[model samples]
Target chain A: MSARVFINEVAPRDGFQIERDFVPTAAKIALIDDLSPLGFAKIEATSFTSPKAIPNLADAAEVMTGIQRQPGVDYVALIPNEKGVERALACGTDELNFVMSASDSHGRANLRMTANQSLERFEHMVALADGHNVFINASISTAFGCPFEGEVRPERVLEIVARAQARGIQGVTLCDTTGMANPRQVASLCAEALSRYPDMALTLHLHNTRGMGLANAFAGYEVGVMRFDAALGGLGGCPFAPGASGNVCTEDLVHMFEQMGVHTGVDLERLLGVAEQLPTLVGHDVPGQVVKAGTSQRRYPLPDAIG
Target chain B: MSARVFINEVAPRDGFQIERDFVPTAAKIALIDDLSPLGFAKIEATSFTSPKAIPNLADAAEVMTGIQRQPGVDYVALIPNEKGVERALACGTDELNFVMSASDSHGRANLRMTANQSLERFEHMVALADGHNVFINASISTAFGCPFEGEVRPERVLEIVARAQARGIQGVTLCDTTGMANPRQVASLCAEALSRYPDMALTLHLHNTRGMGLANAFAGYEVGVMRFDAALGGLGGCPFAPGASGNVCTEDLVHMFEQMGVHTGVDLERLLGVAEQLPTLVGHDVPGQVVKAGTSQRRYPLPDAIG
Candidate 1:
């Protein structure tokens, strides 16, 4: 139990971003408010992207302002540029997340620019947020394996990391944008990235697309990487990224890690309760397990064996 | 590439065993017939157990005789006792899969006998099948963790394996009865089990309850355990195991092994074709990703490029 794990809840930003049905601002606030008391270290509240881009999250500011932020919880918001950063700043977010794709193909498809241009844009956004108490984290999408490109090389991922470090970002998350990575790929890339930038905060963001989400997360843990981003209710996927299942389910990751004697600081039972509301919320059965199947300890009494 | 990889196709037996909706015997035969051409060296076709317990598979005899048997494919079936063995033998099957539980509680619950009684019955079943020209595979269910007993000690698993050896059973599959195993537990247990019984054909049958199914498979693979049991479209779970999500999705496992260059003889495209029918068949979206999301070589074009 000496292991302390960071659980970064990404449901509001990543989960709501990809969901088909529009969840009202009140529901979004209620979801975050419901999760705030669960001992989570960080909860990504919402994204400041254009309403036209992610229509479901059009009321991002309302959700951000409405939620009751528990003491010691860091409420972060996803910001794309100077404008989005300004919006998140007004919402009083404690942290700001800026995402840019690593692969040129993904960068073009996702961000409408070349890799270098995305890097330059991230630098400008970081500079704009200077002197604020807001902590900045730059995430690279498709860092593991891109659908547009069949294989992602580690050097390409390293190049993105070096660029992020140069921009004075405090942290970075290597994302398997399309979930095409195996454990070997995850081990190789994360080991290299963490070794090269030991001081930078690193996290693994993954989808259960090919069913390697938890495995890849373990690979990160084995390589001495902690701080993973997951969505409650198994809510996430990039519409642009092919083979994208939902993000690794929050309760499933919590269940696996907490059972393994890793301290995720997450309340498993509460998370499962929140996850139960998702199917009705999104109008589809989600891809998380612990949420549907209660913990092993939460079992019904069995009948006695007959002679 | 020199690694020995074996696949135990449980689509016929485990796949259809838990379904409420009946697949016609003709369709079941056609499914197995279609799978035989895909280079599966071994396939578990049906269970010869009493139909009183599992009515969906009452027509086991018809399934064994109806399918177009491919040359070199070891067609196996489940047998509980002498009567089941006689039926499997009469059908001219190639392999006999006799399952005994590792945990006493699960043993009695599933087989209506104590652990020792199950082993004693297995000895008789093996003796009766001697000179019957059927390959014997002894599977130990609840080998990882049992729903009844909180944690099934690996020592108990080794005990079951030793019993199978004494009874002259040629192979053994260690199953996670309630999908309650993590990768470290999976690897450590497989290593411990493999060390004691190196010559016994070792296979792992996993459930995806906690989302660690493929990770557990990889852990077992890392420990030099090759053979694995999987179902198409994640379509199976023990009815007795409350809240067990389903068996490991066959295509997901195939995707991992094939990506890492471990041969399993499954074509992803062909497997996805089978998976595409799952939603229509089950009347809901099955918990599989590769079928809905194309392979890496395949990708959907996305707009709004940064690169």
Candidate 2:
């Protein structure tokens, strides 16, 4: 039997923040309410970043408080810094995810600080969450490769992950922020990281920009990495990377995993129903293919002899 | 060092046949001429099926005779029967691809015969091409799973492939006719087929209806299958399968392989250029993702902040 893999839905936060139009807190909470019972390990409710930086997620506190918490699901929020962490904790978020880039150039563009500054700040945030019951997870953006810096060396990514681990972070996410990851690179990095830090919970946050998102995820799985991040309707892309596409579609990823006998605990039909609502909410067609194509077992009737 | 993989371009035949408007003969010749030098092991130039069945490929003779052939490339023509074999031989085709479905339901729908009758006809077609100095390759459609039959037994597929092999066929293609294959199924089938017929050259013809095309291709590669068939712009879905998508995009497949350090010997930039031209010819936007989102190595300039 295959081991169980975790599907962490990041649509409400990562997917919504990139959209120019504002999704009201009620709709966001409603979607999360519908998604809560679909068997995801976590749902990233919203981001606690500055409203000026990301106007779409200005209702972070409202969304975090508004969602009817599912018994088994963790409601998480993205924390930009200490202020964000304070807001997240006050909102009663079950977990806090902090972002730092592996490359200094990307770090400055995304976080408005160098990699070192972000790493240093994560330590203080960890201390801030010390007394709280909330879990802490750190994400290393551009871990596979960077848009500005081009190919990010594996050593740079390892350093950032190592620092996060040293700070006693519960989980560390290696983000392929620009969708520039390949299977071999992912396999190599995952092998090395898991070999070195066997105890650290490693997750992969991949984008389908170049259509290699699922391919890279499969590679990571081959190396024994279990957790993955995806968004419904293929929403979310790196705002800094030019021409980049959305995150891997959660339904498509779940479809692939379920078909391969990898248990993800996701109800595909219900998840697909949630994904079907994305086009109206996002005000455009989504990048997802599974919704348009249907599942593999969805068969067509036989045509007559003339047809 | 990585082993070299063979890419067979099937857009001219498989892709064009599905379109409503007939591409001009001159345009077809021009596209094939452009594709000839792109380092594909073979180009499926055209099909010799009855015009009533596939009107788009009616100019088979013109297409077979019109192009300038690259020295290392093999120009192939699809033969539907003894009549098609005669036509292909007259056109000086390098190889003849005979197709028969593994399931009788699909065979009747596609070939107007039962599986056994089609296999018997293929044996006759083999004799017809025996002294012509042309190669013979047989394709088993619905080899993975059939849309009508629901689940095609693996034993049925192996029987057809073994019969083809016994007929002195050099290459055999296991076609996922309606994109119904999952990675585990592909891996298992490929492993079993390769183990039984160690000398037979196996190729995978996959579709992306459920978005597992690249994942399935990667699985096949992992199981020691080196040859793959793809359409230029994700064109060519099974006409019989409702809501079906296109063939695995050639550029997407090449991108995955090249990123994983596997060599396909195809120039990606030039292939993308050809793929870009497919929209006008087919009168619709192609399903390929790499053209919209450029190659992983295509780097963007950094922002002004010391980037």
Candidate 3:
């Protein structure tokens, strides 16, 4: 049997946050409820950031509290600071995902704080969850490369991981915020990170901006990194990264992994069914290919001339 | 330094053949002329098949004879039979890429011949080029899986390779004609083929229909298969495979390889300049990502808020 992989769906938070129009609170809840039984290891249901910054997900508390959670699936909420952590805890979030940036410029541009400031704030955020029964994950944005500051050194990313670990964060997601990562860099970084912190849950958050998302994910997987963060229909893009595209499509990722004989524990047919509804929900076509073209298992009839 | 890889541009033939409106002969020549100086290892200029079958490429001779060929680039023509060989040789083609399908149903549907029939015809075709100073390659279509008949066994593909070698074919391309291949399957087959016939040139032809194209290419690269067949702006699709999209985008493939530190001889900046013209030439938006999202080296100014 192939080793099973973990997928964390982030469309609701990461994907919806960037939409021009706010996804209605009930629609968000309905979507999460629909996705809960699909066997994802985790679902980032919403973000508890300031409404002024990300108005699309202003209904974070409503989304976190409204969805009927399923057992064995951790419902995660993106928490940016101590107040966000407290809000997520009040909504009974299963996991608190702390957000930061590896590059100081990106940290300042996106979150109005530098890397050091974010790390300093992570301490207070983690402290807010001390008595609560919740998992903590720190997402290091632009860990691969920054749009404002290009070539974020692997050393900087490792340093941030080390700092997050020191703050009692159990997991770290190395994000390619602008889809600037290549497969070789991914393999090297993932291998080094896995070797150094074998106990920590290291997740890969890749974007399809330059079309290297799956390739980078596979590289990470080849180097023993198991968890991945993906969005439905490849939705989500960093507003700061001009001309950038979406997060790696959840269905496409699962389809590729399943086709490669790796177990993703995802019901692909059911997942694709949900993926098909994305365009209607978002009022636009998405960047996903698997939903547009069926899975590899799909067989077509011979051309009419042959038949 | 990373190993140098070969990229064979296939847009002139594989991409243009499927277009609804025939690309004018002069335009075809112009495109090929523009591409010749970009340092492609080989360019499949056009197909020498009967115009009735592929009307879009009716000016195969015009395209082949019109282009100002570069010294380092080999100009290839898709040869379906002895007649194609005769025509390609008349056009002074550097290489003749003979086409065949691995599955009998696909063979009959696409080429009106079974695998055995195509192989038997290869002898006559090879004999036609016996005295000519031209390289010969066989592209095994649907080598990974057939849309009609699913799951093509690895043994069957190997057998076809052996037969092609016996018939004096110098290179073979394992084509996922309809994007049905997975990375694990690609790696395993490529490893086996390379081990058994270390002398023969092997190439991978993938499609992004299901979004595993670059990942499959990387898998093949990891196993030491160095040559790839990509189309400009991800043009080309299998007509027999319903809902299938284009071949892997050439610029995207090159970007990934270059970013990973692998040296592809082609100049990427010049290639992207050509790729940017694809939409105007083809009268449609192309699937390539690198052109839309600049290379990883691209940097953006900090947002107005930060500045």
Candidate 4:
């Protein structure tokens, strides 16, 4: 397996979209600018969804156009349809991450469309981005399993992958939307996906809802899946999925990979410094562990009682 | 690798010992009684230490004698010295888990003894249990890394294991006292321990301080170490180590294993029922995720708006 892993910071999009209070437009821009130099392969800057659906990210265009873009980092935006693609292209997004669900029920509940309908929208969206010099990626939500409809078969997920590939998508992120993925299942599905779609850029987006976030990420890493989508301070969760919490924490993931001798290309000190500001940013405690408990290499002074 | 994993519940001993208030004697007994029939291989009922040291568990004797012992379950006690071993034996403890630290600084700070001194005490403690029909296990704290003294070498850990074995210690648990262990280091050390002490019943005791608990346990499992020490609701921490919090959660660990087709012999539904009562019992919310965000098998209803 490869020793180097790619990380996509998704807090700005996945995390901010679920927050109760709307983060100020300037704060969002400042946060993205802070993350730009942190060696992230990509940053999901914002979603160009309708303000009526997700008002938290209503300032998506301001966030996308305001931040100072760092070289070697791709600025990605979540696009639900052709309109989203148009708005994202207008803001000069480096990547367009088209979103859909593997399960029909979730697609309707979340995206207001079924899988086939989403695919049809994707074809038009890809045509809209034809001359924009943007990378097109498809994120298949509930790829592991579904909340309403249980046990999304691997075959169903693969069929969606095949359909996305037929629509000219360059990358695919298998999202365990509600933290329903187990390590064994992740390894099996990721290994099969790697085998079937060798040319596709595969990314694993996981949630820590059941406390298996890092474990699932490790499972995917063991199976040769290199790219991972994590939120800062483990922010962002599926509101539709009850009890759903933070995404896999970005700093925590980097700390684990760096401790394992794998190359994450992240400056841990700088990442942690940014993570320390998350609770204040969100006005609540986040689920991330490493920010509270220092990294493994952290040393504590001997107890004063010790003689 | 074997699919069968043995879980030793350590919430009573580990979790209670660190709480700010002393859990009522009857409450502790009731908790143990609830866990008895849950199909755990062993349960660390309490620690036989001085009342002044761990005031929260001062009623260890009452807790041990009060619970109705279930057949096929081993009730274990953490023994710090000869007096502890005698007290545990008098309470009819099924196992005597001798506690030590691989690093001298932590041993002195936590146990008031160095590794060598703890080993010397273990020899006498094992001798005390010679006539009793009890299993002898030694827990080497900071086997992964020490907070005060970072990077406990693998060879140092092996030497302690060798010494413990020479002293009639039948089982050993390598503890990540402050959650400093990474999966790669865990795999390497656990594989070495399994190879060197094939006859010894090896267990991995991990903390989730840095969010690598399940990942470390999985790494150990991948290398044939089947026994694990976990706390109910992810309670417990090392007071001597700053920023340390929670052991690996018992239900979460079992959930992950059962999801992966590994048999934990634990009735998870019944276990979750017990876990649900943890917050009220502990007087606060716990770090456990599965207890709050139901297992992966949990299914939520679709949004009412979705028609």
Candidate 5:
């Protein structure tokens, strides 16, 4: 591995949902369409989650149908159950992401099931996806640390990964659900999983909860984690987790990696332009710093700047 | 070593200089007075830089003399040149920090000189401090990435470190003057420097400009770096760098270290209390998130939080 990485853009789905106002499905499609040309390998287009659960993304179907797809981009969606999967599959989802929390409290509050039951349900979801030739990504939410459990054991994460692997899932995403992860924890879990399961592909879905997302992403990169999840302008949060933050900003992460000579196949300037479009679309100040300050390497000579 | 780290608070000097309003010398003294009991080994009390250059801290002498110093806390001052040193020593300073840029362009923009010239002057400054009983810390600004030069070589950093060693300064602080450091860059430089000069202590001064400050701090930690520069409430940036950001937030860094069983010897809540006072004192939201969100571990249950 020559340190190649994959970037998954989730701004359209998770980022849009966090906004206080309802961003129209056409706007969501347009945003994803603009990002389509960027070299993101996967764009999680929308979620087939219940409207009541996340009212902001109520028109997930319209977003999925309306986007103009780029040739090489993998547009995916988050599906909660058989019904959501049916809807996503009906709408021609190329990739399906099924999420279940590792914590029992979260599993219940989120999915109305225990971890074991969620795993059993995931088996059915995987079976459903196998029939459609759709790749299923098992995202174990709150895998690093949960708001309820406080400290989630690695054994639990490994257990979930093992089960996720057993179902022949395409990959597993370790999410810092409430953004309770530091670099040490991110390094340990991702390294342990990748080491133990050589065949299992691991991805990181990070939140900037304590401002450790990019660092955690870098730590994973150090351990040969090339695939990651990010949102444009750092949009998205666990709406349930009050005081929690948005995901690692796509532009910021790409800017950091591209500057470091890590090839992410993403266009930095284009991403920045895409990010600048969001504030007006969403009617609020988005929480990204890179778009605001410009890249650190970006500078004009003082004389020229004055000129 | 068991990761017992030392956080040198540079908010008063580094944080205040970039800030436009002149924080009263009385407030500067009171900040140090209030912070004296927080178990910090060193507090950068004030800068004796050209008051004409940075008029905000013109009363550097008043602040240096007025702080209620605890017995062991070493009050350090930033010395731009020999003149700054003479002024600081007269005000009863125990430690002196001399800064120079690693890149010629930034050096010119910053200190109105070249890199070679700055390094040469550091030797003379160190000699001046030798018999004066003042501890000299040679801070190489823009060591990670230069605002003018895109990437800074680690060999150049080592060369500057070697100069600091030749002058027998206390140690060298590698400042990410524009907050453009990554974990790998931080790790490699620290490892190489520590290997070459085992006796000289290494400190990493980071900026959250790219949101990798804490990660860079940890990268330094993994490679046996124990001394770090953090501003209370994340309140500092280099004015010379166009898009520079604040240093690593003190409370955030302390929180990470304390949680990892890495003893910083600094109280987390007590540090947060200090951070909380900054908004009222600074009249703006200082960048420390822990003040607004509480510690990473401070999770609120909905039942308790709703009321």
Candidate 6:
């Protein structure tokens, strides 16, 4: 296993998109700017989807332009089609994230099309942005299993990746949209994906819906995956999938990996300070454990009376 | 690996003991009876500690005597001293659980005695109950690490196990008192314990204080551990330890294991129904993931509008 791993912070986009209340553009910019220097390999700054689909992210263009840029950080924006691509490119997004479901039922339910049609739409976006300097990354949602469809085949995901690869996409994230993955399943699928696409940079976007998110991440790590996508305080989940909870918490994931001797290079205390502010901003408690319970290394003083 | 594993339910004793409001004796019995037929290998019915110490469990004797017992189910009780042993034997508990800290500072702080002193007290109880038809299980709390004293050596746990083994104890529970255990640490210590005492049965009692409860359990399971302790709704924590959260949730643990094709023999639906009742019982939301997110295999219907 590598001594260091990379975390792509997705709370500003993935987390905030699911909230009912629209966070102010200034607040979104401030949170992203606060996280810019926290040693994140990538920051999913905002999404270029229509305001009608996600009104919370309507100020995406302003937030994208407002945040102070760090030198080494890759600022990413989620884009669905050619229109989103045009918007993201106009804002000078460092990376554009395209997504489609591996399960046809999920694709139909989520994107109003089949998997092939979504891939074709992605191809159109890729063809339209041919001269742009930005990198393109694809996410296969419900890659492990889908709520609408009981099980998703690995071959289907591979087929989607093959299409993305043909369109010159270098990275793909396999998302457990409802957190239905087990460790052995994760190990086997990740191993299979690596075997089939040796050069494609793979990242796992897991949710803590069933509390197996970190376990799945560890299994993926054991099988040689070095990149993961997480949200601050486990912020987001698919609204369409019933019983789906939050994404894996960034601070919690970093704490676990760092405790296991893998370096994240992110200051946990500072990250925790940011996570602590999430409840007040979002108006409810978050699902992250490390925020309520401090890191394991925190010590307690002995009782004075010893009763 | 075995197809089946044993989960010892500790909610009644471990979870209820920490609550500020005392659960009624009849209610405790009702919950235990409800859990009796849900396929738990063992249920820690109550603790026979002094009423003055833990007023929440002051009705331990009544709760133990009132529960409806199921065939093949081992109903256990926690016993802190000779007085507790006497009370437990009177209630006809199948197993008497004894506890000692692996760290001397924790031992002094929790039990008001040294580790050696606690072991001697256990030996006296063994002699006093020589002819009794009951099993003895000792838990070495802070086996992984201690909040009062940092980094408890594995040798300390080994030493306690040796003493318990010499006194004819059938099993030993290595508790992560403050949930400081990582996967590597659990794997190494469990391997060493098995190597040193090949015939003695080992069980892991982990806390989810740092959100590593299931990960630690998986590590232990990988290293030949077939038994674990968990509370329903993830509803227990150390009263003395600051920032301590709940124990690993029984429904969540069984959910993960069952999803991985490991048979826990726990009925997920029935267990969930019981877990659903806990929020009202405790007057707060639980920490269990499955209670909120449902099982990984749970399917959702496709949206009619798909908008």
lDDT of 2 by residue, A63-153 (tens): 9998899999999899989999999999889999999888888888888888899989999999988889998999889998888778889
Q: Show model 1 residue runs off by greater than 4 Å.
A: A241-244, A303-307, B1-4, B242-244, B278-285, B304-307
Candidate 5 TM-score to native:
0.95
TM-score of chain A of 6: 0.97
lDDT of 2 at B160: 83
Off by over 4 Å in 2: B305-307
By TM-score rank, best first, the candidates go 3, 4, 2, 6, 5, 1
DockQ of each: 0.50, 0.67, 0.79, 0.76, 0.46, 0.65
Per-model clash counts, in order, read 15, 0, 0, 0, 0, 0
- lDDT by residue (tens digit), candidate 4, A128-244: 899879999999999999988889999989888989999999999999999999988999999999999999999999999888898898889989999999999999888856565
**What TM value does model 4 have?**
0.98
For residues A1-307, write the lDDT of model 3, one tens digit per residue. 1277999999999999999888999999999999999999999999999999889989999898899989999999998888898899999999999999999888988888999999999998888799899999999999999987899999889988998899899999999998999989999998999899888899999999999889888888888988999999999998866666799999999999999889998899999999999999989989999988898888888778878
Task: Give each candidate's fraction of reference contacts reproduced.
Answer: 0.52, 0.70, 0.80, 0.80, 0.33, 0.66
Best by TM-score: 3
| CA lDDT, candidate 2, residue A305 | 54
TM-score of each predicted structure versus truth: 0.94, 0.98, 0.99, 0.98, 0.95, 0.97
lDDT of 1: 0.82
Instruction: Give model 1's docking category.
Output: medium
Which one is best on DockQ?
Answer: 3
Winner on DockQ (4 vs 5): 4
Give the chain B TM-score for each candidate: 0.95, 0.97, 0.99, 0.98, 0.95, 0.98
lDDT of 5 by residue, A197-270 (tens): 87877889998877777778877788778789999988888855665568988988887787667889998888
Model 4 pairs whose backbones collide? none
**Docking class for candidate 2:** medium
Give the runs in model 4 whose Cα sits over 4 Å from its true position. none
